[model samples]
Target chain A: MYYIDDFLALLFGISLLIAFWKVRTPLFFIASGACLTIIYSITLFFISETKPVQDIIFYSMACLGCISGLLFIRVMLIRSISLHALKLSNTMTKNKKECSIEDQLTEQMTSEIGFRLDDLQQKGFATLTTDGSGQLTLTPKGRVIAQLVSRLYRAIER
Target chain B: MDTLFIVALTTCILLAPIAAEIVLKGRRLQSNVKRVAPLYIVIALCCITIGAYTHYPHPIVIVMYWCGYFLTWFGIRSHLESSILLKMLTTLQTSNLSRDELMSSYLQSYSTQSRIAELKNSGLLESKKGIISITPSGEKLLSIIDLLD
Candidate 1:
């Protein structure tokens, strides 16, 4: 039982360090959560005289749950920052009724959107390739992700 | 057996929102975490009370049980709040939205505007005569993000 307490404390302490490092990606959190679960489970199994499987499973499940919660919060904050960046990048003048006569969104929003596109490409979830008419199309990976999201949307009815 | 029962109950409590979503035919209640979280909390508390009366397990068991509940609460709240991005992704997946249209619509939403107002109120940015600018602290935050990237 004391070991379980120590395990929880250590899990949270490592999670805090990761948060401070600003590694706020969902993938990072998921990977860390899984990795830590396995590592701790093995450590506890070997270290305990009785090799309790139930304790190991319990700790692993708790770790995964807590890490997932932290990940969701972190990603939410990161997405908000993206919006804040777009807002902060706004450079509208007082006299101008619009940031640009042609652009509905401010220049900053466009640029941030472009950055997000580039980021998706860099992450290999997407790619930018111009067609014969200079139109862009999703890569195979992008198509797969898009299809998955669409299916999920239909399933959830959201 | 007591430990097993507590663990199973915690899992059920954690999964209640999903079950609620299914039972309600995917209709969310007011789209707020507060609306659904209390039901889970009440259920958890009832189980804990009954378990305590029956067994009076170690204090650590009680502490661990509540910690799990806290994690469940946080996870549920975060999931509900962060569904905005999922919604956006779903929209993008189903239909095309130009960058301008997307950002403009996002800004037009009352919640987004309120969030921006919050940033301004929190001193991360300031609005003067309709022009918004990031403060030094905001710059510091951006720099940290950049470093992380």
Candidate 2:
């Protein structure tokens, strides 16, 4: 019971990863994170001593756990798309060509990028234009999200 | 009052990286882990040292510290790097783009060569006599990534 909160938080994070293991989408991740957070919060209440300081600490742990889970899912999403590097490595490893890094570096990872664009379209950030031209355009929702991301990019640094 | 101080401390921890990115910009440290890890470590150490010195107050303070630490480290890394998808959408907002245009544009985040250099730096890959190959660590990393599928 000493650091039960930390243990519970770890549990919540694991539950989140399990929930996201199959779906691998933000909506699924969000739904699971929220549900797990609520369940854990309720469970914590049942077992907690309910001391003012103690309860505060316990709830804070749950909250942080939920946030960490959410952040982790986001990292996974980014890493998933960024696995173009992995794909490239796989390609090079499987290839017999003794190409220089300089030459191989210029290789086009078109399929992965195509998949990402298709994913963006599925997520409603962009859409294929209806003129049968297949031109991809951002939706209003996507514009807003893109704006927000751009702002964050400006606000922070690498 | 104690909670107030804890909240302030947590906020400071979360902001340290952004602050470092701002304050340390253009220096050699702005590169990557050299800058971010140091900030994260120093602040985490400060939190632990202070917690130990005070013999700890309420235990939830650990929650506050860890919450801030998690957000600061992973949050910043994702925000800085993972926003490639968002960056693509941002570019689209300016105008429609074919896949090639987007890939070949200023999308450094999606740039595989840079990513290779990064992984190479991280020891996931190695370059010899201008050739590139993956290390065993990189093979392990890809296998782990495969689990997500």
- Which candidate number maximizes lDDT? 2
lDDT of 2 by residue, B1-149 (tens): 24644665567666776666675563323124455666766665666566555544434435444554555455555554555567688788788876667776634545666666667767777776676777787788778767775
TM-score of each: 0.53, 0.67
For residues B1-149, what per-residue lDDT tens digits would candidate 1 score against the true structure?
A: 35656665667665765654564465433233445556556665665575566553323334344455555555554444334433344444543455444445444542444545555655666666666666676666656655544
* Candidate 1 regions with alpha-carbon error over 4 angstroms: A1-51, A81-111, A128-130, A155-158, B1-7, B10-14, B19-31, B46-149
DockQ of 1: 0.18
lDDT of 1 at A11: 55
- Which digits, one per residue and each the tens of the lDDT, describe model 2 over residues A33-114? 6677678777667664444655555465546554564556456545543355555666777794565544444444455566
* DockQ values per model: 0.18, 0.38
For every model shown, the clashing-pair count is: 0, 0
Tell me the lDDT of model 2 at A47: 66
Cα RMSD over interface residues, candidate 2: 5.0
lDDT of each: 0.52, 0.62
